[model samples]
Target: MITRTFSHLVLALIVFIWIVPFVALVSTSLRSETEAKTSGFWTAFTPTVLGHRFSTHDKGSTVEFIEMSGNIFDRLNGEKSGFLVSGEVQSILIKARIMNPDKPGKTKLIRKLVPAGEPFETRGGSLVFQSNGDFTWTFPEATAPKPKKLDVFINQDPIFGADAYIEVLFDNKNVPNALISSFIVTIPATIIPITIAAFAAYAFAWMQFPGRDWLFVLVVSLMVVPTQLAFLPILQGFSGIASWATALNAWLTDCEINDSCQVASKSFPSLWITHTAFGLPLAIYLLRNYIVGLPKELLQSARIDGASHLQIFTRIIIPLSVPALASFSIFQFLWVWNDLIVALYIGPNNASDLVFPIRLQKQLGTFKDQLHLLNASAVISMIVPVIVFLSMQRYFIRGLLAGSVKGG
Candidate 1:
């Protein structure tokens, strides 16, 4: 009992530590930039109050409260600008003006800093509010012939401070296009490498050929080389090829050489090829290890029954090796999806061929003022990988464990 309890405690601690950062990341993505800027990412759990920040933008004690949540908590035209309702403000949205820091200006628009559970009341309006967000606004019979009366209900979210995700979605307009481009770059890069690696891995594992071990060693050796070193040469080669293709096209067809012969200069093809080359070594190594351990009895029996190599490979090996394939597919998918450096070097800064990571890098470098977007963008990038992992996590773990056992 003691041992089991201790083990459970340790596991819970490990899980908590592992999960904290992801929770923080999610909170940051859903946070308003103003709130994130003032407090920090983690404070999205308990967002800070801006404290009825709206002041006179148009002038007069009657400040126009921008309509929010079908409840416009405007200031009454009176001696002092006081809140309209009393009771703990569960949460609210109203436009308020603050001193502009950018240049000479009286006030700039900002959200009201009224966080949920903060107490508030209109002293002049003779109003009282409760913690449940119910408020009663009243006026003396002298102020109005028939006494003015009002009640307001505010919705409360105990977990989140504000509906910042909605605001963030509307604010960042390029997210949809970036997401599409990321898929385009990631899917092909993943499929091409895995398909090619499976063929090569099977050959190395099962077939006997001259210099086979040496060749496998050489391929594995290439994995150690940094992707940076190869970029210059690949870029130059593709440029040369594009130029040749352009010249040939002009000669063969009616198109001018200088005209848009869009064959090169940071394109989809360049990214696909770059990712393929980078991912191939690891894919081959992983699949080869897994394939070698697969039961030799199955192979021998198939061979005795006169089944050809291609038939056996396709019909037998592939069907059984699904776990290893899935494992590597996840790895390559996440790597290509999350990669920034390869995209930076091979992909042009232009949006036409820009992958998601490259686009995010541009946002980070070019728009320093919109720094809060980094968290949102990072969360978007992880969506596909998270889904893939959650769905195939069992296969991924099984493949790794199977491949790590004693070699055939």
Candidate 2:
């Protein structure tokens, strides 16, 4: 029991360690850029710190007082010899420099505290008064003071923790459009490979033909190839395809009466193709193994019923292979959703065609000072994957565990 409790504590600690950064990330994202820079996210949650920092009335140690200087008051013989004191300060600290007629080179400071509700009298060359921050400087004598003017600067000390509302701003309008573009690129990229691989996997598992096993081996072996080698060649090929497509688009635009052609030289379709090509090997490998393990009796029963291959696949295999399909779909979706390299190669880097991943990265270079925006964009980018995984997690686990154990 003790061991079990210790193990749980360890697990909880690990989970907490993993969770803190994300909590910080979320907190950072929720604040305005100015707020995020001054303090960390954890500070927002602590009531003690908040109360100490932003409370206007609290004279706590954590609070920083701001010093404000008022207008220089010139005390003359005929002048009222008074100036208005600002703010709700209980006490005023004054520094007054007076020119001495006796010693022309010497200046004297007549500094004193004038507590609230008492009038400040000018002593030689100084004045002090205090109020609920409305004090007036007065020279008791009618003659001009030794110094030409007495300048007073006031300081207001403030406490922290007043603002409870933190607005997480994702004001970059480009992000939502880029997210839509990512979805456009990802959903099709995920679905197309799965659809194509499912057929190939079904054939590899169920159909017998010349070189069939060899082909399955070849397909599986391709998964071993590092994607870096193919990236440049694939990009080159996509550029050529895009060039041709652009030519066709230009022709269509020229032929049209209303010539508002917003055709891109490259776009989401190319990204989908690149992602699908890169993702297919894994899809086929996982799906083939799962399909191969499905009972042969079911395929035989379907065959005996005169069901066509396509019909059997659509009606029988797909329904039963939901777990495997879902697993691969999640994998491909996340891969394409988060990929910046393939999207960069195949799609235009401009805002018109950039995906969310690329959009978030653009903030680093083009708008690095917008730290809050980057955090918010990152959080926004993560939402779909989180939702996808959460919704399909059961199927993902079931798929992994499907052939792990057998009763027979």
Candidate 3:
């Protein structure tokens, strides 16, 4: 009983660890930038106090005015601005900094909470800031001060929406294109390898051939080899092929030699072939292990009924092996979908062909401060793989555990 309880506790802890980051990621994606940055994701559903700096209108040296009147919320840039929001602020704090006359370029900052519906005094002025966001500033001097900006902090309910997703997905051309390009790259990369491996696995399991066991061992042994070791040789091979193709195309067409006529070494076909080659070793290994565990009577009965190998494979093997195929499909799909190094090395360099990982990586460098958009992009990239896994989850365990035990 104690051991079982301990095991359940461990599993619960593991689940919680996995869930926290996803919860935070989703929460941060939905929140306003200010709310996301200012407070932890735990505070996303609560009222938040957001600080904003707004530049006041300076009427210039010629215009003399002791007082300035406007609504503080008027400075907010509405929905277009990532952080700024306009509403009736129930509580507020005002902060201002003025240059010290004694020290050039040095300033002192003042922060004070305003009484409800009452005027607040500052070092530079007396301010009446209301919950409705209206404010009046009367300066001690004859004219408004230099620099002409004030910081206002207001408390309000958090803003939550799909606005971040909209900006990340539709507003940015790279993200949307990268998404489509990822699907294009991943789908073929997955199917071609599975198709080829299924035929190979069936042969290794059922057919008679010279050095069959030795060849199966050789393929299975390849699963231990790091793909990085083959990169240099494979890349050189691709470059050579592309160069030859480019020369042939140039000779065939009467156009000047340029990228337009040059074959891209990192095209979609190259990516599919690379993924297929790398995936085949494991795909074959898994499917062969599972197929070998099937009832021999099934195959013999088909053979006795005058069924050929191809007929038995298509009619009997394929249908019965759905669980194993689905299992390998999930593995291959996720691997290809999430791959970055392979994409970065042999993948397309053109803007139109960049995958989600590369585009997301570029966004990391370009929009380091835009966490909201980054989080949204991360979530978007995970959506397809998650859907694929969930849809095929029932078959995952059954297929993966194939050959581990035999039925009586």
Best by TM-score: 3
Which residue segments of model 3 deviate by more than 4 Å?
Answer: 53-111, 121-127, 130-150, 257-260, 403-408
- Tell me the lDDT of model 3 at 333: 94
Clash pairs, candidate 1, are 50-113, 51-113, 54-96, 86-129, 87-129, 87-130, 90-116
Q: Candidate 2: worst 10 consecutive residues by lDDT?
A: 48-57
TM-score of each: 0.72, 0.68, 0.85
User: What is the lDDT for 45 in model 1?
Assistant: 50
TM-score rank order: 3, 1, 2
| Superposition error at 105 for model 2 (Å) | 6.6
Better of 2 and 3 by TM-score: 3
Candidate 3 has a TM-score of 0.85
Candidate 3 worst ten-residue window by lDDT: 78-87
- Between candidates 1 and 3, which one is better according to lDDT? 3
TM-score of 2: 0.68
Ranking by lDDT: 3, 1, 2
> After best superposition, candidate 2 residue 102: deviation in angstroms?
21
Q: Output the better candidate (1/2) by lDDT.
A: 1
